[model samples]
Target chain A: MSDILPPGSVIGILGGGQLGRMLSVAAARLGYLTHIYEPAANPPAGHVADRVTTASYEDADSLRAFAASVDVITYEFENVPTAALDLLEAAKPIRPNRRALAVSQDRIAEKDFLTGLGLTCAPYAAVSDMDSLQAAIAQVGTPAILKTTRLGYDGKGQARLRSADDAGAALADMNGAPAVLEGFISFTHEVSVIAARGLDGAVSCYDPGENVHKDGILHTTTLPANLSLAQRTDAVLLAARILNALDYVGVMGVELFVTPKGLIVNEIAPRVHNSGHWTQNGCAVDQFEQHIRAVAGWPLGDGSRHSDVVMENLIGDDILRVPQIATEKHAALHLYGKHEARPGRKMGHVNRVTPK
Target chain B: MSDILPPGSVIGILGGGQLGRMLSVAAARLGYLTHIYEPAANPPAGHVADRVTTASYEDADSLRAFAASVDVITYEFENVPTAALDLLEAAKPIRPNRRALAVSQDRIAEKDFLTGLGLTCAPYAAVSDMDSLQAAIAQVGTPAILKTTRLGYDGKGQARLRSADDAGAALADMNGAPAVLEGFISFTHEVSVIAARGLDGAVSCYDPGENVHKDGILHTTTLPANLSLAQRTDAVLLAARILNALDYVGVMGVELFVTPKGLIVNEIAPRVHNSGHWTQNGCAVDQFEQHIRAVAGWPLGDGSRHSDVVMENLIGDDILRVPQIATEKHAALHLYGKHEARPGRKMGHVNRVTPK
Candidate 1:
């Protein structure tokens, strides 16, 4: 019981977004019950989870109660409040650990960790005030982006500089938050490796998936990404290196920029990544199940895909195409139970499988 | 909204068993919520469903409340009480319709319906008293099965007769319940067709899966059953005929006995069957989703399989093998979340897929 959270054990999930919803369903498949904790009144995950605690992370009593009710805790989003984590951590185990969360919460720490592992990353510098902003621009050069180190997701809290002349305006977009200035580099495409590390120190990495973004949000991810064998191996190895360094115990999405020189570490998400959604149709054990298996102390599935798949996210009005997509052959539609189609909001996704 | 139950719609399931649990998960995938109604406390489906009403079916208030909360209603078990259905049906539409349920609820009605469709069935006669029981035995002969006409499942309420001398004992086993004597047919094998009919009157049928039984319970079902082209087509066409005749609007399991002359109709279930569980691994759209789609008035998926699969049920202690089965490649384990592994209880199932 101490090692494995057997079937019927309740798993507490910190966020109730699509990731949490998918994870809840995967846990249900393995005969585990899930309780979702989210501040939102009507979270998407609430529809599928066994229980949903609608309370803010700042509510100490609620956080403690949630932690007490479950065998272990895992999160969908990495920005869980430190005070809340402190209380919950004292009550129950939080998977992927605080170090992994801490490293990913801050862009500067993530970049430092990656570079420290001898991994390649874009030229970047930290920024606090106008003086540092100017210095960051001078050091990183033109065509850079200034992004807040925390609470940045799906292209929010980011401002891009076309050249040095735009540095002042881009810095203003930071709104006095701690920011990082990253110099842009020429790259062929972007790819991500969805990797996992188990309690037993076993690592399994899915094949690199080529990513396409629209309006700074992920648009699609296609499997069997165009990569030299060396680049593919480098992407997987670096992802493993990050997980190992953090002593991670769940699925992590490692984003990389494919440059002519080498693959550059762009960023990493401590939880299941949108880029790995294609695995739902391509592999026998999907990313969500893999995460649940790892956190539950079960044996890891060898990351082997049985089909070639192209996963396209249904952002906002893209859900309008579900009727037509549902009629298509080999298309598996996964909707997040989102009621409204707000622009840029992730509504759902479709994985189109091409049998090998 | 009149034609289709859109995402965010709540689907009401009548039984809180493993089938309802799976159906709830599938509905969640399509952005639908589910509420399960069952008499038992802490049902397996309650872990995954949006809500669970733990009240007896005879409670008209509970049935009405359950039906009123959801846009549409469906059932996982065929034996749902007619009185409870009457209350629910008055409040909401029940998919597969009352006709399908009525016909499948009683053996005599099911046999009559099948024979009415010009389908072949085992020779049988209904009996209610001692004189009638003797007459039935004389008509069907020995080496037959005398089963209760109503509420029989998994070999329960059944008594086998080895000779004419065994008729009185087999009749006594019925315990004054209405009975039917069916002459056993020498069949080479048994197969089942998982078929679906949409609201648009379109029909789709999955490939016939050969089944093997142990202790009168399903042990395994293998895909691509050894059926000639004509036999396969015949099996599917007959299933479609049954659905069309009933004006069914959901997935139906049609079990058939493959005899020397042709495929004989064994029985019909107006919901997802255990034999079709293989579709979870073999098809793009599984039987559960197909049922949900049909009940929700969505277009039916053309039943197509991408891989060969053998689905084996984990009865009782067979669940203990999960630790080892979890490590096997290409084997997908699905557990019911039931606490005790009682003998003959279906604990879970494993779908072993063979990719082409």
Candidate 2:
């Protein structure tokens, strides 16, 4: 096994959102210094990190300096450009590796990779133009989603095809960028398994949580998801199998569609995920610390739950409910230091832990 | 309730130790800024806080500027001189109030306050000199301890009178300082309840943990302490009563001696205590964050444990065990970023959490 980075070693982090902010806090708790690299002024992560590099991701000189200043590198978001990853990889080790990022950055690549791993996914086809779109429609039918192959998040860059009449306008709106058409799968519920794989190949997973989404954004996650014990085991095993297959390091979130028959892979997040936020107040080890330990080449913490937990996302104006929420006997509130609670933005979350 | 301080308000902390360090991190997590006002250069708390004020306690101008810069003042250690507190209190509010500090700062006053509250304590008497020492010996008897009335911590400024013959030398060594002589009480075990009280009079207490001491410093604390249900309830009630009595507005640690008859109050800490460190990895709301909420006049969080935990102090070279400890399946390791690990110094702690 590789020698784990010692406490006090600097870990370079990409992106300065709330995820990065939480990661910095976790790293600080473990006696590690964090250097955040992000372009935004007054980034949320900058408030707690030991040092910060405020520069554009395309700035090679600044990125190079950032890479040289840390023992290892990790990122909070997967949409980081491949060029930036290449530059960081040349200077220092980048965890979760470029392969994981390569697979997850595009919808087509992610579906193909999962299917290649012998995992089930919704039917999908790449569409480069109207010809491909027509072909994909012929194969996949209407009522499918046409999404850009890259640079899409939070319901952006996607359109729904309800019938043959909707296909042309969807293809025309693509503006010539590469895209993919995926047939929608009717599933009973949505769930996610957040698991971590250590450098030593050890894997541990928290219990799967049933998720509810509104407007393509996560709204809530309730633990002890409505899966039979056997199905829960299968879900966790599938997550572990994917981690081992990718030779992945750090925590990964596997979003799955739980159908009547079985589970189908939806997407993979190579970093600490929003759905795993419940672990902060429900389990022995949180996803942020688990990710840090894995990237630092340390052993994975136990992912056992001691309470049945429910996590509610506070989007936009919902943050104003913090005062009332704080009065609850079982609620633990966490708010990100964002200046404005813009609509659809994740401002904070409150975890309610009940005795098992 | 008074208006809750906004996120950008600065909190002035009077000590720059591990407790201060953790408090600063907690404050930042809640979006409030912290300015550590410590006399020592390069204090541990300075590593993570937004700002640090390095000036002696006697520097009135610096003290005034620091007070003016912060919205409110709190302290990590209870031994701050009354003069320093007086200077700061004139400018900003100090949580927990000066009355609690006055009562806790001196051993004689603490014992008197506890006894005055109709709380059980070991037999004790004040000793002002040789004459008073002899008189106190006659009243409290032999096999007692003579401790200086003020400025003592971690077993400093105290002498044991194991036999009647040791009394004269113990008195001489005290150097004419006001002192307290306490008759030893045989106890089954030692435990502490870490609890918090908010401005609204809300109180929350973590389960009392059995503590083991080595060389006068806490070595370990195991949760679900080997105490009967009644004993646990009584311990928590004692802590809450103390908070109510002091009108405390932050986290407080109440140390108790578990005698065969019942539990007896040992001492009280007016701020976050070391024994509560397990909350960082085991409970939903840690003592540091609880303290922040209280001092900010915000509602308190639930102090619920999600896991059975054991927290072991990493004193000096013990920090070298981080790698081995990190390898454990469920160990959450935390290290203070101290540049040097001198003997008897607390460098960090590792918490092992197991499902209940």
Candidate 3:
């Protein structure tokens, strides 16, 4: 193939979750075949992928063979083991590169990187022990949250400290791992910018989506987020800056806390985010297709929103409401082919679009 | 699974062409796994399907296994062999039913069925020999088309009869098989209704899309087709009538020739039609998904159009223009993972939506 991977080229994806399932479908839309690598048998993406290698990331032989079978590599999750990345990167190009992954993998590193770019985030300090925890509590104040520095998601590995007395209990929740103490910021709502940068360095950002989380999990993401024109511009620009700084090639989700002062950077995900699911119905080109186009060295498609959309995640028992949702007008239901609907597990999502 | 085939249920699809490829993707969106049965190795649908059985329709063991592995059976094409259908129907429920398939498989039968329902169709006569050919020419005048009663698609197995003198040549073109002679209707344009019927006998129809054909292949399908309010209502009602008459349980494409007399039935496809491809961008529930929902015993989704869309097929060498189309705003491309683009082959299509 030339600079652009032609149709029929294999796109290898790591982690065959719902995001990967949608990505594989998007890859197929662009005439590219996707090979999914996941340890779980009958992973959701495996249902749509051209091939699936059911082997752990530590399986070097499988990893090597997987790398040899595709043109480029991309991923659904950011917590891939470093050694697996080292092996895959040696064989094929990996989009959103390792540095992007490293920064997002650790809380302190991510906050430091965002602050280094002059972006505003919550006041935070690293804590490795009780002495450091006491110092962090004093510096960041009593109403703060203690979070593990790495491998944390969906509010897991986190504890709230109502006061200095709760610091001891919150710090104990971290076990022996290092953590970050983040002072609580009074925010009205949360919004995220789903942005992308192509291999050619062209950047594109979708309209910001307002997010609502329940039980520390995303509940719904609505388009036309409640934001002033200036706030919207700021969200897109800051997201673009992060992508440019990392030389990222793929879609990235940058969550922000909209406070009274301005938008505060919450965290960044180096892959397509759940908050961006509304684009599947609101935009001409969805995030999954946009990421595939970027990593495949093709031109980025238009990401302009055409309709107002409310994307509600069908977590666990929310799938039971599908029959009711199916009868509703303008509701597009997308369900992952997971056998069990365990509590807190994402079963599916519905994108409800308003008619023009 | 109750009345509905729950998530992770297998759906077996026969014929692995572009239609099957899209249907497979739609099935995945609804958390249903698809197994493709095709005689050819490396069929397009196989790239995204959960499994593929590369055996001929006549292979009884393969067909048995394919049927045994799925809750329901459906097809992308109408001309599946009789013996294959008999074996498959014995093992699993086939959507649209065998009667719908039988009527659509033969041109004369389709016309007769349409006329039997008090629907208007072009004057037609069946021809099996020279005497019958002459009789058909007398019944259906000059400027007619002689087409094989069975196994005709994409303008294949057809010949144009300009006058009475061309009858012998047109009959010879049938190769001693059965044929139908249709009197030409002077029409302003061709339009189609993509309608669906659920297992519960409920029917839904998308807005009429006007179609333009080139070289006997569908060239483009534009939404909000040129039709009066009354005509649009009539088009949908007639399509629903046909589906109900056949006791159909899936999406059907009804082609109508807009004539001075009224809408004349050009043809009807038992499955998703190329004319309905615009639904992919214009509507919330596309034809593929509607068909999947109907076959899976799920409620049919809303088929309301949300945007104006013009869908153009990328035939053969037209695939080269993808790079250019990829950069266009509001153009949604869907390509079949076919390796080669031979002349007259439909490699993919681009649905261009007008900004809302």
| lDDT for each residue of candidate 1 in B1-356, tens digit (9 for 90 to 100) | 24888788999998999999999989999989999999999999988898999999889888888988999999999889989888888889999899999999999989988998899999999989878878888898878899999999999999998987887888899999998999999899999999999998889999999999999999999988989999999999999999999899999999999988999999999999999999998888899999999999888864698888999999999988988888889988898999999999999999888786
lDDT of 3 at B296: 96
Lowest summed lDDT window (length 10), candidate 2 chain A: A1-10
Global lDDT scores for all candidate models: 0.92, 0.88, 0.94
Ranking by TM-score: 3, 1, 2
Which is better, 2 or 3, measured by TM-score?
A: 3
Candidate achieving higher lDDT, 1 or 3: 3
Q: Could you tell me the lDDT of residue B120 within candidate 2?
A: 87
Q: In candidate 1, what are the lDDT values of residues A203-292, reduced to their tens digit?
A: 999999999999999999998899999998999898999999999999999999999999999999999999999988787788999999
Question: Which should have the higher TM-score, number 1 or number 2?
Answer: 1
How well does chain A score by TM in each candidate? 0.98, 0.98, 0.98
CA shift at A136, candidate 2, in angstroms? 2.1
**Compared with the true structure, what per-residue lDDT tens digits does model 3 show for residues A15-133?**
99999999999999999999999998889999999999999989999999999999999999999999999999999999979999999999999999999999999999999999999
Pitting candidate 1 against candidate 2, the one with the higher lDDT is 1
Summarize candidate 3's per-residue lDDT along B251-329 as a digit string, tens digits.
Answer: 9999999987789999999999899898888878899999999999999998899999999999999999999999999
TM-score of each: 0.99, 0.94, 0.99
Ranking by DockQ: 3, 1, 2
